[model samples]
Target: MSTTEKSNEKRCERDGREKVDKFRRFLAQFCATTVENLLLFDMGLCHSFPFIIIAALTGFPNKHNLNETLSLTPIEASWLASIGYISEPIGSLLSALITDALGRKVAMMVVNIPLVVAWFLMYSASSVWQIFLAIVLLGLGAGLMESPIITYVGEISEPTFRGVMIAYTHFGYSLGAILVATLNIMMPWRMVGLVCMFTPIFTTIALCFVPETPLWLLSKNKTAQAEKALCWLRGWVPKESVAEELQSLQRYSERYKSCESCIKKDQKCIHPLPTLAEKLKELKRKQTLKPFSIVMALFCISVFSTTFSMSTYIVQILKAYNIPMEPDEAAAVLSYVNNLGNISFLCLIRFTGKRYLYLTILSILFLSAAVICGYGFMVLPIGYSSFPDLSPNFPLENSNLGYIPFVCIILSSFCIFCGINSMAWQMISEVFPYKTRGTATGLTAALSYVLSFIGAKTFYSLETTLSMPGVALFNCIIIAFGLILMYKILPETENRTLEDIEMHFSDNSKKLTDRKIPKLDLSQIGSAKNNSNMPTRPVSIKGIDEQNNKKSGIGCDNRSFVADS
Candidate 1:
């Protein structure tokens, strides 16, 4: 342990008097050097994918009067949309290849390459085909930013505040949305693209200055670099605590040889050091996928559904409602509400435990609200819908009910942020083995994007066929899947280590289902002074042989007492 880590750990454990100081210390360790360094969040990457495009383009490509404005054929607009989805996952997959190899700082900087070049291409575009070409480049670059950022952020953050630190990325997403909305109003479409061309440059600069992840360094067996990186991350924590953390890190180091020595000396599992790919293969072969994986899958499903089903088309739904203002004005208010929702949701997420119960509750509320709002718009056949008559100069005006869709939209987005977004990353970082984290994260991300493709394509087709209520009903169904998976599968993660989680899931499923399972008697457990008073037999292992003991005395009727734990 370094001097600072020791001091910090001592201060953290000094009874209840130093709690405030401990928190201050924790925050100091957690924050990055710049706003751009904080771009590693999945929310930022997801938001950036579409958000940057909106700011750069500054107008809807498929506006009803496309022929008059841009003289775009349906084919050109379709080309851009098609390229968006295709190129998105390309960058995402690229990030996985680069994350561990390049480190977070370099990865972030590297990702800006596609973004900058794409924007430069977009800025110079004078035709619809040229814009489509830019989108392909942009998607390739932005896709790399998506999954890798989540893994990088998770790698760098301290365990206690990791959840909150990751949640802050949603702020970046909100910022992108709000910034694009403003640009759409004040700037010419091409000028907007030109102005945004500088953003990636700024982002790239900040990323270059951030520290590499200590965990990744340790995993690579670079103990010295790991300690140095960790010190930068931990600020002025105590040396003892730092030492303890380092010792824990050393356990993961290939050079430690503890796992190997254990197998060789004690004739246990009998293994030596394995490559990362081998370790991941072992984890998969072991069927080490935890119950928590369900939580992750469900969250991704919800995010994927929200990504295209509501996020991109929400403003479309509002305009479809025939609101009182122009499409631009309607979008502005909706953007404000969406950002407000993100900020408030972030605050709420900090107070939430790892239990995704709140997520389930939010999903229910959002679905209910969506059903009411969408049903009102597309299902109920009210005359003029309390709106003004359609005309050449003036389109139909919206009812008060027109805004309710946004209300539902905002709250549902909050569910995305607090429920699915935070929980997915938190659980993935905590549950997956460090040896296999990179591969597992990469695999999960690829799966997520595949589903995102489904969501985007499904939402587009469904919206045209069924209208606004159909979209909500579709959302309601996806949210239902998330709620069910979360309720049954999410394990409590607060203050618990990954080992604890693994052990829980590794235990027999039937026994875990027992309503009145026994608890450990702390006083009787390893009490040297009262060793005589301790139970002579292990509670769950009576009459069971040590080898292949899954049945746990099921066939034995002797009821012989166990002698030790």
Candidate 2:
């Protein structure tokens, strides 16, 4: 070949190598992010293990059944199951404060302390009260970590990958449920607690190696540290590769600070620190109010839809409905399906928009509930009852149709994990602005837990009062209502940046056209007129003064403005 031909071939070979190398870097980064997310969210196992174990203890035909071992009554078992949720609200509230004040990493580490203690307590418990106390502690730990974990994942992951990463939190919960379900069938509940307790300890150690989120670092004005953290999170890519992202984060932080300081072009001077009333007034901002309302409503819908309540009392519910399977076996199968749903969520989140996916899930859930409730009313024998006595040995007519309710329950579980659960939790981290993220997420999460508490606490009673069919009907109504509200209000957030999601809720954003204006450096603007290489434009002094007066009742001082070209 001629010299030019050889040179062209060599350049092509070099470009191919560069492309391969870039692909390798991206794959490595993705893997590292996946591992970090798994570690950060492993507490999902600890959070969910207790509920299953409690279900097994009260209802499963195990050698260490709490109903027999400790003479635990149904009421006591119900309390053990529902108490965690009630305590979670308090933990969530505390988490909001801790995550904002101490940093997300510190808040995560702090939560492990309670988790370890709660699990250890459960393992060594001899009395019902001890178990109750352990669950309360577990709830507190679960609540405390919820905000930080969601915030950390949201802050650390790229927007392109954020939906999948956030979905991993629910993945952790489903995996935990599966683990505990399998372990519950194979071993005593105490041993299950002991096995699961190690997760939080491992999480604590794993967290030591991970860096704090770059967003949180930037919020604290730790620019160099933020750069380092961002680099580390992006698989330790060279600093220049992430500089553009870092600058964007800096701009977001500055914008937040400017908003906090009440700085605008219309204002004549910078404002001082806000007073107590002024600080409270910030809560009324459109960005805060709109997202907060949407999230809180979603949480309410999720809580009342009987998703968590069913999980918490899976064994009892199955036995109540006279499903033709061992409660433990059904719980295990449901747990597996739950993970499958979460996996489907991870796979589909990239391909689907948030609003569409959510609406689809709710529709399926509503249909599933309707099927189950209809089966109960139409097919069951006339004296069938689940309340006052929940027994796995409850008799059903000998027919293949007995499996239909079980199938519907399984479908509902899948829908819950796939979309209902993930969407609500994902939005908690995505919807709020950085300044109020911890507080808003905390409050919303706390309310969610409280609603979960009510749902869980009332499941058994509702079964007693309304029967399984009635409970299903209640969920159907709530799901339908939620579906309508969500369809009307939820914005599509897939593949969108946090800034874009926040802007979607702002009235001002809707009124303003998309425009990019040059950022003026006040210090440099004064010197622009004297620079030989720079082109300057004249000031519109009267226009500036009139605009300022119209907005803030203040007039700008007479000064010549020079715009640089």
Write down the TM-score of every candidate. Answer: 0.74, 0.83
Per-residue alpha-carbon lDDT of candidate 2 for residues 261-306, written as tens digits (9 for 90 to 100): 2332312224443443554566677668878877888888887884
Candidate closest to the true structure, highest TM-score = 2
TM-score of 2: 0.83
- In model 1, what is the error at residue 59, expressed in angstroms? 9.0
Q: In candidate 2, which residue pairs clash?
A: none
Cα lDDT tens digits, model 1, 1-565, are 9999999988666644356445544555446623433453223333333432432233343232133234443223333444566766666666766876776567777777777777777668777677777777766766677555666666555545555665566566666656655665665555556766777777766665556776677766778877666665665444544554554444333322324334223222235566656555545522246533564565566654463434544444445555555555555555665566556555665566656445654565556656654555664443222111221122334466545554555555555555555456556655554545555665665556565555654554555555445555556676666666555555565534343343334334423222121222323222312332111223222222222123231111111112111
How many residue pairs in model 1 have overlapping backbones? 20
Against the reference, the lDDT scores of all candidates come to 0.51, 0.70
Q: Could you give the C-alpha RMSD of every candidate to the true structure, in order shown?
A: 10.1, 8.8
What is the C-alpha RMSD, rounded to one decimal, of candidate 2?
8.8
Best of the candidates, lDDT: 2
Task: Determine which window of 10 residues in candidate 1 has minimal summed lDDT.
Answer: 555-564
